[model samples]
Target: MHVTAADGWRLPAGPVRRWTLRPAAVGEPVVLSVNQRNHLAGVVAGQPSVWLAADLPAGSVPGIEAPTDLLDGLLARHAALRTAVAPGDGTGAVLHAPDGLVWVEDDVVRAGTSSDATSAVRDLLDRACHPLAPGPPVAAALVGAGAAARFVLAGDHLVLDAWSVALLASELGTPRALPAAPAFPALAARWAAEPALPPDDARLHAWLAFLDGLDQALPTFPLDLGTAPGERFPQRTLVVPFLDAATVAALDDLGRPEGASAYAAVLLALGRAVRAQRDEPAATALPLLVPVGTRRTEEERATVGWCTTTVPLVVAATDDLRATGERLRAALALGSVPLDQVLGSLPRPLRRTRADVFMVSWIDYRRLPTVPAGTNHVSNVTEADDVQLWLSRTDAGVAVRARIPDHPPAVAVVTALLERWVAEVALLLR
Candidate 1:
C-alpha cells in the first residue's frame, strides 16, 4: 500500500495493503439518529469547527518509516472510523461503511531536514480539517525528518469526538484486547428507537421565559466592527496561560470545600468576568452554551462519534459565587436531553437563533491516559462564529484559549475579555 505524493514523497503503506475493509452485513441502510441529524444540520448551517486533530511524538524517523502500524491497528479496531454518511432519499442520512477507512499522505520535503516540519504539519492539518465527503473521514500523515518527525491524525467531528481522540491516544502503542463495544450504527439505531423522555416542564418554562425577557437575543461582547452583510468572518485565537500547577491545586482545594468542582469554579469566574467587562445590569442574565457529554457508561465512553450536546447555562450577574456554582451544576445535570429534543421544544424562531449564543467548554486533559514517553499531544482548533472560551487543565495548570470572530473590533474586545477572565479567576482562587 505504498502511496506516493505527486512530489515523490512515499507514504508508509498501511497493513491493509492488499484489501479494502468490507462490511460483514450490508443489507439495510442504517438511519442517522436524532443526534447525528443535528450534527449534520450544524454543518449545513456553516459551523466551521467540525474537525478534531492530535499530534503524537515520533522517535527517530528513519527516512522511510511512519506510524503505519498505529494507524492500521486503529482503523481495524474502531468500526466508527470506517463509517460514512450519505443522503437517504431526501428524508435523512444513512450511515454505511466507506470504501476506504484512512487517507495517508506524506509532507516531508526532503529525507533529513526538520525545518519544514511545522509548516508541513500545519498544511496537512488544515486540509484534514475540512468537512468530510461521502467517504472516509479520517486522515493521517507523518511530517518532519528523523528526530523531529511526528505523526498526526485528523478526523471529522461528526464521527470522532474528543473522547475518541483520548481513547486512541491511550491505545496507540499497547493494543489491548478489550471487549467489543457497540459500534456507532448500533448506538444510533438504539438511540433512534428510544422513546423521548418528557423534559422538566418547570425548567423549560423558566428557560423560555428567561429568553422572552431578553427579547430573544443575548448580548454579545461589545465590538466596533462595521456592520456588513454576509461577510465571512475570519477566526482568531488567544491563548492565556493563567494558572500554574500549584494555583490549580489551590483552586481545586478552594472549590472542594463548597461542593464545587473545578469546572463550576471556572464557570463562576467566567460569569463574573463577563459581568465586569460588559457592565451589564445586575439582573441581566448572560446566556452560555456549555457542551455536556452524552457518554454515561464505560461502554459508551469506548464508542466514538459526536457524543455531546450544547445546553444553555444562563448566568445571572451576581456576587454569589457559591450560588452560581450550584446553579451551573444543576443545569448540567438536567442537560442530558438530546439537543434535537431541546430544539423541538422551543419555538421555531428561537430554534433558529439558539446556536447564536456564546459557548464555554472545559477539557481536563489530565484524565486522559498518558501516551508513550516523549510523545506529547497537541490540540487542534476549530473555527466558529460564536465567541468560545475553552479551558484546558494541562500539566502547567489552567490554559485559556479564546476563539473569536476575526473582525478587528471582535478580536480587540475578546482579548480584553480574556484578560479580565484571568484576573477574575485569580481573584476567586485567592
Candidate 2:
C-alpha cells in the first residue's frame, strides 16, 4: 500500500475492487508477472479495494465533498468489489488463472484542473468511479482544470475488451445499483455448467489443436518503443484514425469477393498497408493480434467482465492488397473458429501470445451503447481542455495521451494518417 500525491490532493485510505477476467484456457498456465497478477488476485479474493489521488486548486471551494458514503455503498453493491485473493496464492503460474483481483493505489493523471464549476463537478464525479493503482480495468486519467473536467480511460487489454470498459464508464459518479454484483464464483459455475454441443465442441477442440500446430511459426511483435534518439528523450505518440463507413463498406466489398467480413478484410489490408509503409520485402512475416469474444451463448454476451483471448494471425506481406486481404479473411474465418479449444490446446504459449505485440490488435466497439441515442442532448457542449486525438481502427482504438518531444510533430502526422486511412476506406466502399 504505497501512497503519493499528484496535482494537489492526497489520496485517502480508500479501497476499490477491480476485476480481472481471463479465459478458461489460460487458467492452468500462470506465467505473467507476480505483482501484477497474483498480487492483484490476492487483493481481489481477500479485500478488493484501491486508493485514489488528486491535486486540488487553492481558493477553489470543493463543490462536492468526496462522496465517501456513495463509494462505500458502491462497494457493498458489487461483491467482486469486496473480494481479495488468499495470501501466497498470487504468484508464478497461478497468475495465468482466468482472473486476478488487484488492489490499486491512486496514481492516474497528476496535474490538471477544470475550466468551470459544472465541468469540475462532472470531472470529480467521474474520478470517483475509478480506483488508484491497477487503476480501473482500463486506463483512466483527468485532463484540464476546475469546472471543465475531461477524463481518459486506458483500460488494461486483458481486463477490458472493447465495449466492456464503456459499460463500466457508464456507471461513473452515480450510486451503484444494489445487491452487489453476482460473485465470480457463480459466473464460473455457469461457465462450467453450460452444455456443450458435440460438433461445435469438436470444432473448438480442433482449433486448439491447430494453434498447437503453429507453436514454432508464429511471429512475435516487438514493443513500439518509438524512434527516439536516447533515453530521457521527449515522449512522442502516433495519432491513428479509424475507418469511415465507406472504407468499412469497401473492406466489406473486398472481403465479399471471398466471403469475409469487413473487419477481417481490414485486418489483412492493414497488414499489407503497414508492410508497404516500411518497404518490407514480400514474404515479411507480420503477426496480427485479434481478440476473440468467446461468450458462446447469447446469455453470456451481457455478462460483463473480460472473456476474450488474443489470437495471432501470421501472414506474409504480399504485393497484392486483395490477395493479402483474402489471406487474412481466410485465416480469421478459421482462426477464431474454436476459441475454447484453442485456449485448451496450447495452455502455456497462449500467455506469451498475449504479450507478444509483434503486431497490433483490433478492438471493435460498434455495438457499444450510446447514452440511449437521445438523452439530454446538449447541443453546444464544449470541452475546456487541449484537443486530443480519438483514433478508432475497427474494433480497437487508442488515444494519444500526450505529445512526445523531439519528434516530427507526431500529433499532426498521426492524425493526418488516421484521417487519410478512414477517408480512403470510406471512399473505396462508396
Candidate 3:
C-alpha cells in the first residue's frame, strides 16, 4: 500500500468512535522472526505505530452503532493482531489466542471542526496503538456516518508491513472470506526452521559487497542532509505526483521494446536525479535498500505478518533502461532474507548504522482490489535522519513521497531532486 505521513489525509465532518482490541487469554510464548526482531531491535520511547486510513466504498463500513461480529471475527482470524513483541535483542514474542480475544466498545470521541476530528482520531491512535499494549497491538476509529465513511487502523509496524496494509484493503472488503493462512507464529517458526543462507552463500556475499562498495556504510542520501551521525531532525513529507495513467502506460509501452519495465524506468530516473544534484563519477552505483517480499504462497500472501525482506540495489548512473532493468532483476534475485541478518553480517561500524540507509518502497495497486479513490496508508511521525522514498503506482498513475530531514537545505535539494525525477520520467515520453 502507498503510505505517507498523516498530514495528507483527514476525515470529513462526522462523529468519531473507537474499536479497541481486548485480549482474553494469557498469551503463549512464540518465536519472533528475524524481520520482527529487527523491527523491534531497539527501544522506541514514544507512541510507535503505523497508521492506515481507508476511504470506504458504498458499503465498506460494515456497521456504525457498535462493533460488528464481522469485524470481531475478522480480527480473530488474522494472527498478526494477536502476536505481541517487546523491544529487545532476544526472541521475545507471545501470540494471544483469537477466540474471544478482542473487544471494541462504542467509545464516543468528541467531534470538533473537521480538522479537530482528525486531531482527535490521531490522539486516540497515539494513546491506543502501542505494540505491547493490552490485547492486540491494533486499534481502529470510524469517522463520518452513513453508507460511505472513512476508517483508520493504527498499529505497530511489527504487525503491519507494506504488503500487509495492501492486503488489508482487500481483507476489509471481506475479512471472513480471506484465504486460510498460517498464524504469524507458525510463519516465524517455519522461518526459524529453514536453513539460513551460509555465510559464504552467493546471496550473502553479494549483499555484503553492496555495503562495502558504498564506503562501508549503509546508503545515505547522495547529497548532504546537513546532519551529524545519529543526529535526527523532523521530517518533511513531499508528495510528488510523478506520473499520470497515460504517461505510466507510455512508460510501459516504451520500455516493453527492450524487455524493461516501469520499475527500471524509475530507477533510471532516480539514478539520473541523484547524479544531477552533485558531481559523481559515472562508475558510481546508487545504493538503495529495496524491500523484497517473502510471501511465497497464496496462504502467506493472505496472511498478515512482516513477510518481507530488504536487499541493497546498486543502480548505475546510466540512462540505459534495459541494463537498469537487468540490474534490478539481479539485485532481487539475491533472494529474500531478514535485513537484520544481512546487516549482522556487516562490519561493526556498518552494523551500527541507521536502521534505514536509503530505502525505496515500490508498490503497484493493480495487485489489490479496487479501493476508494482517496484511500491512503498513513505513517506515524518519528524523528528521521535517513531519507526513504515511497513509490506507488495505482490506476490513476504513479506517486512519489519522500520522508526527508526537515532542514531547509535538505528539503530544497530533495524537492529539486524529485522535480528532476519527474522531468526525467517525462523525458521517457520522447
Candidate 4:
C-alpha cells in the first residue's frame, strides 16, 4: 500500500511487524459494555473510521532505544490494550481476551535521506488513521530517527477512548501494580441490571420530547455535494485557529458572571452562524448533537472504553446569545442520563440515527491530568456522514475543526459557516 501526503509526497507502505499478546492466565469471557455496543452500532451505520490517534509527548517517550521494545513493555502492563471483540454464542457481542492477541506492534521504514520530522509524522499519521485490523484492534508505529522521531498509537474506538489514550501515554514506561480497575464487562453488567432512578426518567422524558419536536429531517448545511441517493459520503476536515489567548480569556471572563460555559458559548455561536448562513426564520430550531460522557466516578475514569453518547440540543434561531447560552446549559444539565438507557426508552421511529445529526463536541486539553508536557495538539478523524465540529483548547488558544463531506459545495458551506462562527464569537466577546 502507498499513502500520498497532503504535500504530494508519496510514502511506500512497508511491511508491519506484528505480535500476539498472550494472557498470563485464562479468564472468563467478558461481556461487551454499552459503550462498546454503541460503537459497533456506529460502524454498522457507516461511521467506519472510529479511531483515535495522539502524538506521544516528549516527556512521556520511553528511554529505551527501540520503539518496538518500548511498546511491547507498555502493552504487557496494560490489560485494556490487550482486549478485543468476538462474537457471542447466541448472545450479544463479548469482549475477547485471546491467549495470544495479534497486533501491528511496530512499523518502520528508513528513508533514503534524513526526512524532516513534520513530514514523517504526517505520513505516519495518515497511515495510522486507517481502520484497525481484525484482532487486538490497536496498532503502534515509530517513524524517523533522532530529532525527527515520532511515535503513533491507533486504536479502535470500541475499546479505547480519549481518557484511555492519555492514560496510556502517561503510564508508558513507569509500570506499577496498582489496584485493578473495574473492567468494561463488569461495568456493562452493572448498567444492564441498574434501574433508572426518578432523575434518569426525567432526563429520558426530556430527551424524548426534544427528539419528537424536531423535524423528521433536520436542517443541513446548504451544500449540494452531488452525491447519489444512498451513496456513502466521503469526509474532509478543515481546521482553523480562530481564537487567540487574550480573546479566549476575555470570552471566559464574559461567560463567568452569567454561569455560562465556553461550550455553551460555542454552541450559541454555531447556532447563530447556521441561522445566518441558511437565513432560517427566528422560530426555526436547529438541532445539535452534543456528546456526554458516562464515566463520572474516579474508578470509571481510570478504565478505558467508549463511555460517551450524543444527545440532542435544539437551539432557537430567535434567542439572544445570553438566552441561548442559558437555555443550552439547562438542556445539557437535564440530559445527564446514560445514552443506552435513553435509547431503550425511545420508540423505534423516534430514535435518531447516530450518523444523521450535526455534532458539536468540545475538549479542554488543559483539564486532562494525565496529559504530558509538550503535548502540542489533539484531533479526532472519523468518517461520519453529518457535519461535525470539534472545538478544543490547545496551547495556542481555541481551535475549531469542522468535518464535512469531501465535495466542493460542502467545503464551501462549511467554510462560510466557520467564518460566520468566528465573527459571531467576536461579537459575543465584545
Candidates in order have lDDT scores of: 0.58, 0.36, 0.71, 0.58
Task: Give the per-residue lDDT of model 1 (tens digit) for 1-430.
Answer: 0111112222222221111222333423566666556666777666654556555544522222536555665665666676655544222434444334434444234423333444454455455544445454566656544454455566767677766766665565454565555677677777667766556665555555545665655434333333242344655566667677787787788878787777777777777777776644363456666777777776777776667766667776564666777878767765655545544666644523324346787778776545554443344444435576667776768777666666677777777777886788788866
Candidate 2, superposed: residue stretches over 4 Å from native: 1-80, 89-147, 150-161, 173-185, 189-218, 222-237, 249-258, 277-280, 297-299, 315-355, 371-430
Q: Write the per-residue lDDT of candidate 2 for residues 289-364, one digit (tens) a residue.
A: 4545555555454434445544556555442446655555545555334344454455575533321123344444
TM-score of each: 0.80, 0.51, 0.91, 0.80
How many steric overlaps does candidate 4 have?
0
- Model 3, 1-430: lDDT tens digits are 4556766656766777777777666778888877666555443433234544443442554443444565565566788877765335334877777674766665686676678777877776666665556556677777766754577666767777767666666666553455456777788788788766788788788888887877577777777777787777876788778788898899898889878889889888888778777765454468888887777886676777777777778887764888988888888887565455676777755643664468887888787555544567777666677789888998788899888878887788888888888888887667
Clashes of each: 0, 60, 1, 0
What lDDT is reached at residue 64 by model 3?
33
Query: What are the per-residue Cα lDDT tens digits for candidate 4 across 1-430?
Result: 0111123222223322223232343345566666666566655555554556445533357553565566555555445565654433222443444335434433344455433433454544444443233345566655444444445565666667666666666655344544555575576667667767564466677777776666333334333444444544656777677777777787778878777777677777777777787743443567767776667788776676666666677877666657777777766675456666665565665434334457777767666545555433343444545577767775567787677767677777788778988898898877
User: After superposing candidate 1, which stretches have Cα over 4 Å from the reference?
Assistant: 1-28, 33-35, 42-49, 60-66, 87-134, 199-210, 213-231, 279-284, 351-356, 372-384
lDDT, candidate 1, at 317: 54
Candidate 4 residues lying further than 4 Å off, grouped into runs, are 1-27, 42-47, 57-60, 66-78, 87-108, 111-134, 173-180, 197-200, 215-229, 281-284, 348-354, 373-384
Candidate 2 structure, TM-score to reference: 0.51
**Model 3 deviation from the true structure expressed as Cα RMSD, one decimal place:** 2.7
lDDT of 3: 0.71
* Best-fitting candidate, scored by TM-score: 3
